[model samples]
Target: MEKNAPCTTVCPTKALKQDEVTRVVTHSTDLCIGCWACSMVCNYGVIGRQKEARVAVKCDLCPGREIPACVEACPTNALVFLEVKKLSGVKRTEAALKLARGMQGKAL
Candidate 1:
């Protein structure tokens, strides 16, 4: 992230990572408060809070499901379930711009 990047994720240690270094995010389902921090904070928006799961879970992008949850739920057709390596240059630019804007008045 740039120096102006926003601290949108409000975790105790700001446990957000840049890319899917882990490919999948696994956490204790019982401990999640469904805060939607992963959804709000991630530039790629790989994670989201689901009422059905009662916790935040990141995308596995597994087959058999027609679309990922975010892509399916996006009303404006914003979210796309694209393979990370196949993501277009434009999408990456847009994500970076949005994250910079989110930084706004934050000091760090």
Candidate 2:
């Protein structure tokens, strides 16, 4: 079982639930009381309270979408969705290349 967040734990109506398969957190509008408990307890501050609906909202990882809208809209290729392991390898390679270039400049 996934760990319960403080936000989810405090939800009175059980409006928020995490999918076991995807680990995606979702809010059920029907069950929500608009109490803002989830929004108040979210550590990342990703939860948003909609003034119109008064219910908390958050990213559900863009379910059913091939690519996230933010990533797709980025023009500079600066934003990327990558696994942590791959990102770590890339960072390590970049650091090594930077160090090698500095050493080469000193040797010149």
Q: List lDDT for all candidates, in order.
A: 0.58, 0.78
List all candidate RMSDs to the true structure: 11.6, 4.4
List model 2 lDDT by residue over 1-108, tens digit each.
235667778899999888767656788888887899888888657688887987888776677887778888999988666554687789899999998988984745
Candidate topping TM-score: 2
- Which 10-residue window of candidate 1 scores lowest in summed lDDT? 1-10
lDDT of 1 by residue, 1-108 (tens): 223223233543344432344244434455566766656766665566678856777545443577877689889987776655566776789899999999999998
> Which residue pairs clash in candidate 1?
none
Decoy 2 TM-score against native: 0.63
Q: Candidate 1 regions off by >4 Å?
A: 1-24, 61-86, 89-108
Model 1's alpha-carbon lDDT is 0.58
Measured by lDDT, the strongest candidate is 2
